[model samples]
Target: MSDPHYDREAEKYESPIPSREHILSFIQEKPRSKRQLFDLLALADEQKKAFERRLRAMVRDKQLSCNKSGVYRPFSNRGLLTGTVIANPKGFGFVALDKGGKDLRLTSQQMKLVFHGDKIRVRLLNKKLDAEIVEVLETVKTLVGRLHLDGKKPYVVVDDRRIKHNIEITELIDGCLDNQVVVVEMLSSPTIDSDAKGKISSIIGNYLDEGVEVDSAIYRHQIPAVFSEKALKESAQLPTKVIPKDKKNRIDITKLELITIDGEDSRDFDDAVYAEPTKNGWKLLVAIADVSHYVKEGSELDSESHERGNSVYFPHRVVPMLPEAISNGLCSLNPKVERLSMVCEMYIDPLGELLDYKFYSAVMLSHARLTYTQVNEMLEDKKSPLRMTFSNVTDNIDFLYGLYKTLRISRQKRGVMDFDRIESQILFDNKGKIKDIVASSRNDAHRLIEECMLMANQAAAKFLQKNNEDFLYRSHPKPTAEKVELTQKFLTAIGLTLEGGIEPESRNFAKVLKQAKGRDDENIIKTVVLRTMKQATYTPVNEGHFGLAFEDYAHFTSPIRRYPDLLVHRAIKRVLNTTSREPSGKMIEFGTHLSMTERRADDASRDVEQWLKCEYMRDKVGENFHGVISGVAGFGLFVELSEVYVEGLVSIRDLKDDYFIFDDVHHQLKGQRGGKIYRLGDMIKVKVASVNLDDRKIDFIPDFG
Candidate 1:
């Protein structure tokens, strides 16, 4: 094919042979070398350089690739894939394909071209699925880390382990001292020969200072910590108490002896519940804070809440989605206060099946603010002092407990997968240091409130579906085949099996858990089973939640904290008072954004907890403690201390008189020579070796003479 745009090229350049389009079309069928192309085009010596420059530009733009043998070929769309880079601290990385299949592995050399969380295109190498970076679509622009000074050279060590490279500090602000946590703005991206360069944008504080972990996590995860001035102004203007106009056309349930049951430390109460014995079975009323009533759509408060998505609860503090003026003041369902609410009233038969439900706006008064401990004591013992103290709500507690038992029967019959994992509470001293870490027990009171909230959420989803309204559903898809296979292998190694062959329901998992109960390795079995399930997320497509075993489920209970619940509140109101329907496109956008924010909050909180745990163990080095093998990896074993509820790693090298080999299927390390095995769930004594605050890691070794 001759140069079709040769005349046009000649008008732009003095020595022009063919346009880029012409050259590409000619080489599209078969890749050609530069010399071959020069001979084919019959180009003069002077024009060769210009043509070569074009080829290099095309290659830079990923339009073409030059093989090692010097052949230029156009990229086939099938040969390239787009994905987000998931980097490891070890310098190797993987690309999670957008369309969802097995991830493509990237070598350390290739990982140097892109940072973690960057979206990029990769070209498949072979059947083994190794990939090469083709082009970066997006790059991480900032990082959060601690500043380090090596003589005159200043650099930043990123807090996120997934980011491997140490960013060179090109500029530092005044008063930004070494070893202090700071946020860095990327000046240049990393390359094969050099590290990424950045400037200290803002100093968080001293790395070891009290409450610095929370601040660092906020910046590290890019979570918005401060509300906008407009949002604050709007919140400050909100009324402290519910006005009479706010109760217009809404049911007045202020006289009902409804009560809130939460943890002892909980401050922002969003839900109040009441139950009464009825002829059919029971009548239950769940009143949630009407946050939507005050935070109108398109208002600054609403915008700020949407951005936050949900409250981020830390061990010592909380980053609320809404301002305190709304979340803890006007919208909070505090005791003896008139508060606007969105109520879900349900009628259930003796069989525990939901018979009828209705949703409406209401003015509710919480008669008492009860803690879980108080409620449990009142329900567990008739002569309990709490019963005498809260005599007014004694009948209400009995009614709620009866309803909860019936609901438990229904939940068990439906095969709800329950993982009775022991949760730990990190109690802090007055000096803001960890005083003690203890197991937080869950009682019947907790179950009662959870069941009530679940019913209300279900009713909300059912209501929206019946009205043909588009909204976000809490969706939990089935596990991937790969994860399921690994889990099955682990189960089989332990003389157990997941009942479902390929596509199993929640009941199958519940059955496996039931069989594993009372066994010594029950926690191990439950942990492996839990790992096989997919994470639940908000989506407009309504895939249904596999974990909760719900056909229809939406968050309708905590509008004061969760954005999806707020959105659910708005959707319900739209159906009740107006005929307007939110577009499906907008719903999808909201789902994705809210899901991301939820994950961000989880990551930030986890980071803070890990840092605190590391700090707590800093002074405990050389002390021996017994622990259970929580995890087994090729390099080490992760053990959780039975006494303190802290986790640390015992490196394979630390094992005595054995060359350990990792057994992935059995979740253990086997000795090649000594025949000693360190398996998951095995209790072993270990001595604390060291703690790294920067990495939030603790090292332990076997305590042996």
Candidate 2:
């Protein structure tokens, strides 16, 4: 009564199908057509539909792939490579090679099937360096974005410009409005033919609300913003003050006239210093808050602290690694408070060479909490108000100043590279809008405290090394050959040369920097040299610090914020207790993770600052300003405004007069017909043409008239 084919298909849909393993095993041996596979398995007509469903599932899982000939095989049999997709705002992407080769470029059409940060398997197209998305192993599951409305439909646009797709919202949370910043939970992964679906998880706030810029950055970077319930409970139950028993084994240094010097806005005072001149040289005592005593290993608080790795400092707020109860209350070296500390007592010669040092737990009281400005005033005039107020520690402050001078000379002799870069600080209004971006000044007081901390850190590193204790060291490797060559070419283009052989030492770079000082392109030269240097990272293997020119260097201060410092403290304590245990293998993994978290925080902070800068410039469109060419690229020249410290791109299209060609070797963009060149460090006038808040970009055009 029914058609034979329809009846057969219906019967196949109702029958039992072969196991996925069997199907995979058969296909993995050799590529097989769908009909051939069905026949090989001896599947009945009634099982064909179920077999097809399983095949589709396998393909979706990336375990199987279908060829143009309708043949299927295990993905492993194909010569596809696995990598993570880094999407770009321009609709294209790159597959970061998993095995450390050149990245495979992907066209916009291929990028449409995947999102940024997706783990994917890609196949090279025709033996070229370009790849096509073959399968997506994983998709971005959560995102922070702004909510949008399209007629009757609502969607979320991810703030990360690299992701070019809008997530269609299936459900909206209460209180969510159009254009509000919200966190979204993806409901389904994207496929080649469909977009990702999501539901609003939490509404952050209005787009332009106070603190929303920082909040958005926090969420976008996946920074842990809140302490766990267990950590909070532990913090709440902790003792607010140090007790008598807590000071049992500690050497009492409460009478040493120690003082804490910090920035005006610093909250958590971590280290206090006291120095006195000796017949031989000087005696320096550096006391740091013993945060490990309160937050023990394997505790809930410690777990959370380790996960956070380090505190993140934004403009007006901090995402602390430890609870405030510990970081700011119990462990802070507040003035007049008796706190537990780990003290580094060092004897240095007049030449700033360390003769000897020892570490011990101690009870110390900071006599005064002085700011850099106050200390600078006191140093310049002994009759300053702050000097009179804290007269008890005036002699110690003066001795510290003398010791700092000695250390400065020693550092110069040691060839440490000190780049005189101007750092900017944002002044925020009550509503958190940027009032001004001013250059942060460095004074004598800042240098004094820095030298003191450096001596202490060096002492800690040497102590751990001599005792053969396991510890994390801050290591900076020399520049790579490729980078060195590029730097040399750039230097030559600027009418300079890098001395000290092929592998130039830090002193050579220092010499070049000194030579470039007061020059018209001083900042540019410094920036280029800095770019040639490699980034410093924490490692268990000591490779020495190239920038500091120290044979051994580790971060031993600020344990309240940095995890590496905490580990150093713990290791020192273990050595003090005469224990001989090596650090666990897990410590290496933790070091790597901590380094990544540090970079993540830096990136997140920069993102927030850029967003704020864009908001600040929104109202200044069409205003003229003087700027320096900070970057040169094929598309445009990046100019940093001198008045606001805001950087914007001057697109080549807006150059107007001539076509520009990028010169990568010289880091310049030159015009074809006009012969005009835009190079790094060249000062020029520009007008703010546009500000795109959605993309967090500012655009500028040359003001030739």
Candidate 3:
């Protein structure tokens, strides 16, 4: 018999918990594709019985579908697809194809000849868009995974859950111990079927090594740790520095009290913002390091950066977009360096209204390199010896702070919703252990920097707007009816009320949030309300950003790490400096693609980050921690621990004695017997139970008082 777990979900889709009937029928019913068989049997076993009877009846009635081959399929007779497999541990997965709406559902066993993360050919058993994966054309010969010895056999547990099964280590090449993640090479492939066999090729490192994140990020991102020969050859020839006379002119370095403010450990500084109170209002100079000036479009360096898409910054290390020579040296806006930059000069008034904004190309000298901690301390009147280091900007910092206040007021008036949540920064030890988790707050300096970046991005949006041009503008669609309705119900259950529904837009939501300020569940409210809004994405068709309440917005800062920003920088330069140059229609289209690609890279990066963070928190298992309910699910509640800022699943199964039902409308998990409710923004205590680093799942036992 097939594995019990496998057979359960593979059955007909009749169980409250999906079972294996559908998968088996799909595999057994050769005439019909898996999805078709599943959907057919899923309809009613009574009518689906007797294959000839069901087919004859369906054909006679013309209520069902089939092909001329008499082999029923989803799309066509074969219902096959070539795509990438995205796996979840639930034994089912989705296949992402290159074509539009290309995702199809496949079961664990139906994943024919493909391994997780492998590009493969799949055949749909049924005419369903989501069918079981029927084939995998190519398996990743080299993979990164954890080594776990089960009895006599050792298995490389894949970090990527998309791979349905653990790869057995036919040979432990380096005396690799259990629970250590290692690299593997595929030694066997299913000749006529889907399963892939592989061996542990090399021991990468211990699971929680300090450098593991960088290694994982590089592999997951497909980033080459070393530069290619072609890329290296190109970088070697590149000018180390712009010639003394090559610059347009010696731009004022001491005149403007420009500063770079970022995280404490930041190595690459991409932007500097300086704003001085002007006669009419304020003159804000947003200078972004000119990366395009060196990484010329279509060059080998450009091609490399494009392939990398963006720099991946892990806690311990960074996978740079360009080689270190460019990212950390020439292109970095390090203080005292005369780096090329594209500046957005904006004049604004006390009312937070922009009088005018213009994009300009220039070379800039960063007067000081500051960190958020330093700026925040100065703002809070904490003792700082380095206060003298930024003497020139001491008074200007005051001015910048005042401008951000005005911008905040202005932004509020414009209905922008600022979802300010406490983000946790994980500190690491030299050995790659999580030293401590620190709660990060948005301080005056952060706001000042953020306001400046927003201004530049909004200006980019307006630039194209005024030109009446079709360009890639980052947009977020309004919430859906179902999500909005669900959110409304949740708000009412928590005794919170909204004046208007989802139609009220960002300002309205901001007002509600402002009203909920300092409340215990404020973060929870913000998170869920955000869930109701559409995710922001790059598109030529502008729908505007509902979250920022911006009719126009584009990323015009941080070109060092983000491709979209570089593209936006190019567009801005073309508009500001190049009088005869026009952005080709093709160029705009490419930007859109790059923007989408960049978004995917960001998502992947975030997933990897979240996974590693969870892994780091594993050592603290069984320890009780304070957390807030971040989300509500049918099976459990999501608790984001206050101390670590790491989120874990608090399974309802372990929440006291009462049977719990998901009160989704309340955004909480409630006990049916006691009427105990755990809402989205509720404060709760939890003890960590199981930390499945393999699943990136942290199971918490909720403290139900």
Candidate 4:
């Protein structure tokens, strides 16, 4: 083919070769080696040097790509793509494309060359978009798993069930035994002919050892659970109590009846609340620990805090972002002690609309430390004896309760999402054995504090946004079109209607949940509706929070446990002072890191909870319980026990008498011959058949007999 821009190239260079456009066109038809391209283009020997230079430039510019064998091809989407591999234990995977679109499926055979979370280049195999791994760009260095000896040779079953390959143990450390949880360092990557090989780096513990679940989860999720030497030293150097200098140049709100309300077992108090009736409506003050004041920017302590991002709360343990001295001591708003804090004071009308707000550094003394239950008891009954005990703050609590009701009304009017999801808390006996898993219910007191924090966070966002300053905002985007369509189809299949036409608001979701109330499949409808929403994230750019129905929002509470709140405190300080230095770091990158850390903490917590739940079910085999089908997959139906809240899979193979076909859109399985159907949210009786501690899996079977 002739060069399309030959005249342009000729005018630009005396020794011009074929234009880039012409070269790309040629390679688009078929990849050509440098030698073949030189022969086909009929370039003179001297011109070959210039032609090679042109090819290099084209490759550099991403117009073309050169393979290892000197083969050049067009770098177009249809031919090749780069993405992260999302692996499945069922022996298949998908590529999450860098440029967002439908994920390309990788068959079991094609997945052998890569590990989960590996970034790789893939070539399109056919029209169905089946992809073959072209090159692995990155590999996960280490994995946490249980070691097992198959007769003589040893192998590891990865803790993350997504990775299906049993890695061969090339070297095992001394004292490591069979069925022990260990961390393995990869020695060789997987290939079509052989499995991955690794050496044991460290032994966590025996698979069933007490507290082994927490240890395994910490390692598996790569959560930084230990404090660094420098950070600890920094913490030690700080004074044990609030000093006079720390309170200097701060507004004194010590006389105000500010009280901290939290859970019964809570120790690290991050915020305190005070409220009074104002002429407009009400005056509310939310005082957060001034962590940025102590943990200076760029300090070792700050670095440690930023690395942890947020505290990880397990069943009985907490991986705190700050050291105990800061998180549980000086920064904590303990009762009857002077504490330095960053305060957000807001004035609102009777209708609960925020009218005006002010941010300032303050020195405050908490009058009382209250629990949610105590607050609820005091507010619910007029003659409650506890009211007299906390008389110093009961009036203040009443004022706060009034403000909470107003804010709740405002929130409802604003169309905020109210998901009535029940969270399970695992109870352990004195010896740390599983006792029971109970639902943690939220009451008005919880909502009061939540509303208070929401208002403060919203004020902080508005304060920074109005100043035109760059800061991280808690962003929750609207759901994608694809998810909405799927949810619509599911709702339609169930004879339900999502109110909003296409782009629904939070109110629309709330309406659906209300519609599903008391129905047999209410839980299923709630789960599906919840799944349609997008995950909230932290970003420098302000995208309004969809779930909270907030036009402006940032996390300004819990600086003691969250790094972003610390950043917000610093930003507020900078805006409040002309000489104060702004917080350091690229805001965009910081947001991304914090978001990932949040997810990491959640995953680690979930891992520990799953292990505990598996252990809880180990002794219940053969015991039948009533459950609701929570999830439907081609392989099985996941049932959540009614009272215990434990989930187990009822495999399709155990569903006797017929071959079942999975209906993905309807979320059900239909028997091909008998026409028997099992669906998500259908109530049924199931017996605990087996439990796999290593995999953290519980298996159940239908107990019709």
TM-scores of all predicted structures: 0.89, 0.90, 0.83, 0.86
Instruction: State the C-alpha lDDT per candidate.
Output: 0.89, 0.88, 0.72, 0.89
The 10-residue segment of model 4 with minimum total lDDT is 576-585
For TM-score, the strongest prediction is: 2
Better of 1 and 2 by TM-score: 2
Candidate 2: give the clashing pairs. 11-46, 12-46
lDDT of 4 by residue, 1-705 (tens): 678798999999988889888887778889999998888889998899889888877864668866434678777556568999999878899999987798988888768778888998887655787776667888888899889985678999888877888789989899998899899999887866689999999999988888878888887777888999999999999988888888789999999999999999999998999999977899999999999889999999999899999999999889899999899998999999999999999999898899999999999999999999999998899899999899999989999999999998898788777776777888999988889998887989999999999999999999988876657999999998889888888999999888777788888887777788888888789898888899999998888999898889999999999899998888898888854444346997899899999999998998888889999999999999999999999998999998898999999999996899999889999999999999998998999999998778999999988
Write candidate 1's Cα lDDT for 1-705 as tens digits: 677787898898877767888888868978999999898888899888888888877876778876535678886557679999999878899999988899999888778778899999888776788887778888888888989986578999898888888899989999988799999998887866689999999988998888888988887788888999999999998889988887899999999999999999888999999999899999999999999998999998888889989999899999999888888889888999999999999999888888999999999999999999999888878999888888888889999999999999888888888888877889999999999989877899999999999999999999998887878898999888888888888888888888787788888888888889999999888898898999889998879888888899999999999999998998899899977485578888899899999999998988899889999999999999999999999999999999999999999889967999999989999999989999999999999999998888999999975
Worst 10 residues of 1 by lDDT: 61-70
lDDT rank order = 1, 4, 2, 3
lDDT (Cα, tens digit) per residue for candidate 2, span 426-513: 9998877899988886899998999999999999999998888777888899998888888888888888888866689998888888
Models ranked on TM-score: 2, 1, 4, 3
- Model 3: per-residue lDDT, tens digit, 549-606? 8888877788888776777776666665544244357655666557655665675567
Q: Global lDDT for candidate 2? A: 0.88
Q: For residue 142, give model 1's deviation from the true position in Å.
A: 2.4
